[model samples]
Target: MPPYPTGSWMPVALSADLPAGTVMPAQSPAGPVALWRTRSGRAAAFADRCPHRGMRLSHGFVRGETLACIYHGWSYAEAGNCQRIPAHPALTPPDTIRVATQHVEDGGGIIWISVGEPAAGPPRFEGLAPLRSMVAEAGIAALEAAAGTKAAGGLLDYTHDDRAVQLLLAPDGQARTLMHVLVDEDSNPDERIAASRAAEALRRAAEDIARAGIAR
Candidate 1:
């Protein structure tokens, strides 16, 4: 249902895609998450459930530094603590009334989320920059078969017309996969465009292979 599980950090989205003071809905192995950022440009994720009345927190709005449930205007801090309750403005929310949080790491131009304690930080590609991301109607096996290479250290190596590309992949439970394209950090506009196109073509090929049930 999500990018990562218990001990590993998986790249969920690019850092640029999520702006400050915004919340996006996502699924996780643990549960649904409201991936959000604060006004000051910090990223955090909360269990997408509002313990108050079973509302989805992802449908909530972001305040100065808190996420407020759209239903009753109950606000929660990044740490998942209840910050304010509009109905009881004078009452401090008890510690038991709080949202659950996941481990989030924003680094290397990507956002990583982990369900439980992560063994380490997100993997870094020293000389690669994220170009774009897309979903492919294929499994990881199909992608690896099309690329003719196995994933190493969370990065899949592929060559497109003499240009090297690194693909960061997140596999959904079904046969779908989220592919994030990474290219040389020093690449020019034309090179970046080419790499992006290459990734698209690869996805098409992978999808075809998947449809034919040729990849194992």
Candidate 2:
């Protein structure tokens, strides 16, 4: 299987994992990102580093519709503009004091971030719904070896116990991968559980293969 396009939309997290008024650390092709959702439920992604004190923005908290740096209370808007500086409340913050932002899309129960300017939106699987996400200590080659199949367009199809499950992969660093499991939208609870387990098993097998240096 070919690697996912580095400049295209990459699935960073499941939509359900990021609730309103929360921030989480995520990986993008550019680097680490502070993926967050405002109280009004808008998803946004910003450079994880804070301009002031060099703190991680993902460790910050959300207030109203803004994300505030945890170290010195520097607040930033969803558009990456600096809104407030606690030490200089009487003075307006300069527009230049802002974190770099990236394009974000929330669709089909997934959250995607673009590392570069994408000509179109993220890929959509019409009848599949996301089940869960897991981090594997292996690469795409190991996954393909375990599943006996290749991935195309960042998606791999695996069959377990006569049931079909889709795996969406996002490479994280050299040998780590983030896998998102998807099942039919109309699947029952039992089937969903089974699929989740199957994915876990696959992850273990792939990791083993990677550790043994046998993945191709």
Candidate 3:
């Protein structure tokens, strides 16, 4: 978890979390993103700010294949080019009006956004299934200290009691981290619930350790 370089894939969200015709705000190493899916079910990420009046584009609406800003109703295509200006429907919007775009990939139950051109694709969890995602108030160092190990290629092996849970961490800003909980694909319902609670406990401990400056 927490790949630091700019030219790599960052797992930003879960595919199930972003439904068709909806937009949500996500963060990347570059900046904030307006992650959205078109009515036709194609996903794309754009700069979160609207070009018209500096409004957050994540507050926009999705119609067909375009995302429209809620403030001025300026719609943009998936490629980040402005497609329509409601105020001047007769005039085609110029190419100059556009938002920044990032390459997005969805697989292994996670949504990945690329800040720069990645040489390869995101890591695939071959034998695990994503349970849920949570925001931890601690950094990666703290999480590693709490888990008693460092992550390997985005997979953090954490042991609770005798059970093992794989945690995938994604960084947000500086002091926070996004934790994606992964369980064995064959885990039972009880095991899954227990794993969730254990992850929460780990988060609390990591946060405490980070606050106390004990994470090294």
Candidate 4:
């Protein structure tokens, strides 16, 4: 497997994991982010830290369309501009009082965030749909060792019980990886369950390999 690109789209979270009017903490190459979706179903990513008191915005709540910091109740819009300051109800927040945001793409049942300006959108798996996401204590090398194959284009293929499962890998750091399990769109319930369990088993194997200092 090649090294994870520094200026590419990283799959941060599964779309189903972040529903409308919700926020979740996600990892990006740049750092941590608060991935959120509005009531109207628009997805956005912002720097996890609130500018007010540096509180993690992921600890905040989502209003109708804006994310409000739980600390001072400062609400910010989808564009990352501060929209409201609860303490001064009559005052409009200045443009400078805003959180930093990243480019977000919601496609193929995945939420991808760019670390820098990318010339194209995220890669799409045409006939596959996301099953679930899990964090592995191992790195990509261990994953490749466990699966007996390398990941290409951020996707690793694993087969079990004659069923094909795709694993999307995003390196969380030097030692951790975020794994998203994907199966064929036409997969039945049993296939989906098997795929999920296979992924869990793969994760365990990879972590064990990493703990033994075998994957480098």
Better of 1 and 4 by TM-score: 4
Which candidate do you rate higher for lDDT, 1 or 3?
3
What is the C-alpha local distance difference test score of each model? Answer: 0.85, 0.92, 0.88, 0.91
Clashing pairs in 3: 1-154
TM-score of each: 0.89, 0.96, 0.95, 0.94
Which of the two, 2 or 3, has more TM-score?
2
- Give the number of the best model, judged by lDDT: 2
Q: Between 2 and 4, whose TM-score is larger? A: 2
**Candidate 1 segments whose C-alpha is farther than 4 A from its true place:** 1-6, 214-216
- Which residue ranges in model 2 land beyond 4 Å of their true spot? 214-216
> Which parts of model 4 are misplaced by more than 4 Å?
1-3, 214-216
Q: Give the TM-score of candidate 2.
A: 0.96
The residue pairs in collision within model 1 are none
Residue pairs in clash, model 4 = none
Tens digit of per-residue lDDT, candidate 1, span 77-196: 988999899988999998888999988899999988874677778788898899888989998888888999887645788887887788998875578887889988999999999999
Candidate 1: 10-residue stretch with minimal lDDT: 1-10
Best by TM-score: 2
> Tens-digit lDDT track for model 2 on 1-216?
335565679999999999999999999988899999999999999999999889999999999999999999999999899999999899799999999999999999999998578888898999999999999999999998899999888898988777778999998888999999999999999999999999998899999999999434
Per-model tally of clashing residue pairs: 0, 0, 1, 0
